[model samples]
Target chain A: MIKVERLVKAFGRQQVLRGLDLDVATGSITVVIGRSGGGKSVLLRHLIGLLRPDAGRVLVDGADVTRLHGRALDEVRRRYGVVFQGGALFDSMTCAGNVAFPLREKLRLRAAEVATRVEAALTQVGLEGMGSKYPAEVSGGMRKRVAIARALVTEPEIVFFDEPTTGLDPILVNTIHHLILELHRKLRFTAVMVSHEIPEIFEIADTVAMLHEGRIAEVGPPAVIQASPNPVVRQFIRGEPERAEGA
Target chain B: MTERPLPLTLRPLDAIGRWAIAVVEALGRFGTFLGQALGTILTPPFKFWAFVDRIHYIGYRSLLIILLTGGFTGMVLGLQVYFTLVRFGSEAYLGPAVALSLIRELGPVLAALMVTGRAGSALTAEIGIMRITEQIDALTVMALSPIRYLVAPSILAGLVTFPLMTALFDAVGIFGGYLVGVELLGLSQGTYFGEMQSFVDLSDIMTGFWKSLSFGVIVTWVCTYKGFTVGHGAEGVAKATTDAVVLSSVLILVWDYFMGTVLP
Candidate 1:
């Protein structure tokens, strides 16, 4: 389980997160949604310890990850797999090498084992025979899959996806979401994803947390959030103009 | 009412203060990066093959440029020195003058500048691109040290190869000088060779070596830091690469002056 308490973060004069709080139950897919620049990615960055909150705490299974440093921080990070917005594949390496990076760097797996694990992860992402291709050679959707394979190659307990399907077409989006569902079902890893796909992504989310004005405006199952009575939530979901100023 | 600005009397001081702060901040950040990169130079998870691969790329692949510039510089130095020496019937001193300048000053400085233009710019652009693309962040998420995985190998390779490149530059430069002095200017080969052998000291050679070594550190350090901390997008990468090449070249010449004054 992860708990965030009154997370306050600021960039110079711009206070992005102000007294924000949220939670993630163990082994659940929590999809955080928000308007562009509403700090959805910022919150995710904080959760992963990429950006420490200016004030408040991020507790990952009761461990204050922000306070941890050096080897302790590294150990905490190893338990996570993150798929960045751009896939973030090392351009110089082949797809196989990118997938095998964490394993080779952290694990003492044999060459044969590394190759096997890489192949398995690629296969899981439906990219079995494309191991030798570089990130530049693959399409945008395929690179995302490679990123997913790299993320899961370590068999992490948790995976963080930052706008996984944002840039893809509708078909590729469905494919990616289904792939995420298939992998989540098989791997059983806790998933915390930030997505812009509204009605579409609600189908796969176990909990949809709506971030607005730096705090979660509403958080519940998909049906509850869709039917939420809060004006801000309604206006946001319907893509409608505000009914009143500061309502 | 509009708020009043600061008094005009203190405006220049304020601007100066702001400029000073930015410079100090940049220096502090670069120093921290250097310290971190140095710390990881000998730690565990040693990527020996990666280090060697960088050497092959930075050292062996750079031979052609080093040779071309070195040869031209030596030939030019020889021609000019021979002409100047013949004025006072001191044409024989052409060998020692050209040899001393090549081995002591031109070889290390020119070689460093060339490498900075070629390798340093490339390194800065590469790292900057990685930064914009979030590959560095990917490494962090993987529990891997970017300094260890990305920077140490380049720095180590620069250290290992800069001197070798400088030596090659000096050899070609000396030969170029020899051609201009003996073959073109009708100077005796024995006089030219004998003068260089007698006049050039071990300390002169050591001075060039030391300078080139320092140049290697400055180039790699400045370039990598620029790339690692690039701002955002393609414009940022281009700016960082330009800054790296310019700053490294300026620092090399500045440091060379200081070293010349200090070294024997």
Candidate 2:
């Protein structure tokens, strides 16, 4: 379980989070949705210890991580796998090398065992047998799978996806959405996804938290979020009402 | 987290605050850089050849210019000293003067300065580009140390190349002086060779090699730091490449002075 308390972060004077709070239950898929620059990414960055809250604390299993550093912070980071908005795969490495990187570098595994895990993770992400290809040789959708494979290679307790579905066509987006859902079921990752794509994301997320005006406007199940009377929520949902209906 | 807003005072205090933040960020980068480099030694998924490639670029390929510059250096020194020696009816002293000068200081320092410009700048730009593109970050998340993978091999190459290049400079320079003194300055080969052999000392040769080894290390260190420290985008990379060469060259000169003062 993870808990956030009175989180406050500021860039100079532009306060992005003001006394914000949220919680994640074990094995739950929590999707954070918001407008652009609404600090959704900021909130996620804080969760992984990438960004320290200015005036609050992020507690993972009751441990305050706001002031953690060095090996302690790295241990916190190891608990979660982050897929950056840009995929952030090492370009110089081949697809398999990228996927196996954490295993080779961070985990102590036999070479043969590392190879086995890489193959398994790649197969899990539907990228089996494309090991030697570089990131450039693959399509955008394939790159995300590689990043996903990288995230899952270590079988992290949690996986944070930052704009995972961005820049993909509808079919590819759905494929990724399904991949996310299937990955959660198979790997049991506590998924934390941040996106501005409101409606369809809920299909994969167990719960939705609409980040607005620096705080979660509402947080609940998909059905509760669908019936929300909040005007900001209404406008965002209706703007993509057709997508939701199709979903 | 909600970040607090700052008022635009544009005051001296604000300037100081900005400077402090910048210093802290630089220190943070240095810590990351050192850790990554040291980490490479232990981390798995190592790329042995990538580091060797960097060294090859910085060391082996910069040879032609080192040779040409070193050859010309000895020739110029010989010509200048010949004229001075002639004024005192001692033209034969040109050989010993040129040999002593080349062996002690000019050979290693000048060759290293040139290599720093050529190879150091290239390495800095290449790594800076990698850094800006988040390639370095990608390496870290993979648990690979960028320093161990990229820096250690280059350091090794520098250690080997600097001494080798310095020897080339010393050899070419002395030979160039011999050509000018015996062929152009009207000094006999026997006289030139005798004076040169008599004056050259083991300590002088040792000083040059020490400077060469240290120079190689400095060139790579500065270049690697600049590349790794680049914070901005392409503009940051460009600035870092220029700074790498300029700072390393300046430091080489400073080291040369200290080596000269203390080594003898």
Candidate 3:
């Protein structure tokens, strides 16, 4: 339910996103794969109205979020949930408070109702009985889970994951991916995730888009992308460095 | 090879020009941030609890320091002023001297400096950490204005607390002066307070009030803005905190001078 058209963003002399175009289908998991600092997070920020593009437009559900500002931008963002790489849980808040924040702020529900939903969200993420603990008190894996619970608590129409599994161990990475898959299966929220999980992502992603040189080099279903003819795609999937010209 | 002599003709001028431009740009950004923060305070759906929480943080928590510093400052004034006035056989004027300095100048300026060291640094570090950690971004994506949730309340609290704290400082400082002049230095108690009552006027009180009010806004504004615009990483937060405190302290002193010159 999101479309990025000719999105161009630059930082001083360096260009990060150059005429990058991407489309995210409704209620599907679209994982964007790219090299580190290839503007994946920057692109995601633009989609979520966190960054204004230097040029081009980001349309979510037909409204050009690029043009929206102030209250209008906020209104559009209300439907969005983002899980930052660090989880970004308010450190001063307990796990339950973090999850209940959006509910309390946006929904203005009664305290009893907010607590109930927070508990349900925590339970859904296998974090039951962990609500009272502060984010600092939790393990890295549990923090990520808490972040996910916070994101999904509001039942947002779309969720953006910015390297949610970046610093986790292998098993925890798999666990998080599986948890995301399960949640997607249940909630059916449209997801646009930026990740470097490679083959692991192929199993969960409805569509995989490979970003290269500030553009989408390849995009298709998992099988199609795996078997693609493009050398860049092939090289990336094989985890090989650039070959010498004649070696 | 011998080192080449640096070109000194236009370099200094160019450096000055660049510095001037940078200063102007920073000022513009700060002004815009102040406007936006104040606007958030004026807007609807005001977060009353957030404002109260900040008052507790920036105001109530700062009481002990203000009192301690104020008391010592007054005692110092009493000691020094008594010695100076005694030389001229004008020791009777010690009360007015201590009272005027504390009420009109030292009270607001020193209290602000103290708060800058205490609450201001913490505010900057807290918000800077939040910025680097993406908590601010999280708030944004959740459709919450970080300015409203963070900046507005802080600015409001500053506005509320600065003057009140200044008043507290003035009172305690006067008492401190009384302790030193009348009790320690053998000055008559009635003469000390009676002289202060005769010389200190409402205008002098108003001067401190105005100065403290402005200092409050400056401290909170600079601190919050630095945190909100922190560069990146741990280093960024550290630098932001340092900059916030340093800038707020400098601004407080500078503003105090300007106000001192203008106010009655």
Per-model tally of clashing residue pairs: 0, 16, 0
Superposed model 1: Cα runs more than 4 Å off: A241-247, B1-15
**Docking quality (DockQ) of candidate 1:** 0.82
lDDT of 1 by residue, A88-141 (tens): 999999999999988888776888999999999999999999999999999999
TM-score of chain A of 3: 0.97
- Winner by DockQ: 3
iRMS (Å) per candidate: 0.7, 2.7, 0.7
TM-score of 1: 0.96
Candidate 1 per-residue C-alpha lDDT over B32-128 given as tens digits, one digit per residue, 9 for 90 to 100? 9999998899777777987898888778878999999999999999998888888899988888898889888999999999998888998999999
After superposition, the stretches of candidate 2 with alpha carbons farther than 4 Å from their true spots are A240-247, B1-54, B61-96, B139-161, B172-194
In the range A1-247, model 3's lDDT, one tens digit per residue, is 7999999999997999999998999999999998898999999999998889899999998999999998899888888888999999999999999999999998789999999999999999999999999999999999999999999999989999999999899999999999999999999999999999878899899999999888999999999999999988898888989878998
- DockQ class, candidate 1: high
* CAPRI rating of model 3: high
Query: How does model 3 score on DockQ?
Result: 0.85
Residue A157 C-alpha lDDT in model 3: 91
Q: Give the per-residue lDDT digits (tens) of candidate 3, residues B37-125.
A: 99888988899999999999999999999999999999999999999999999999989999999999899999999999999999999
Q: Order candidates by TM-score, high to low.
A: 1, 3, 2
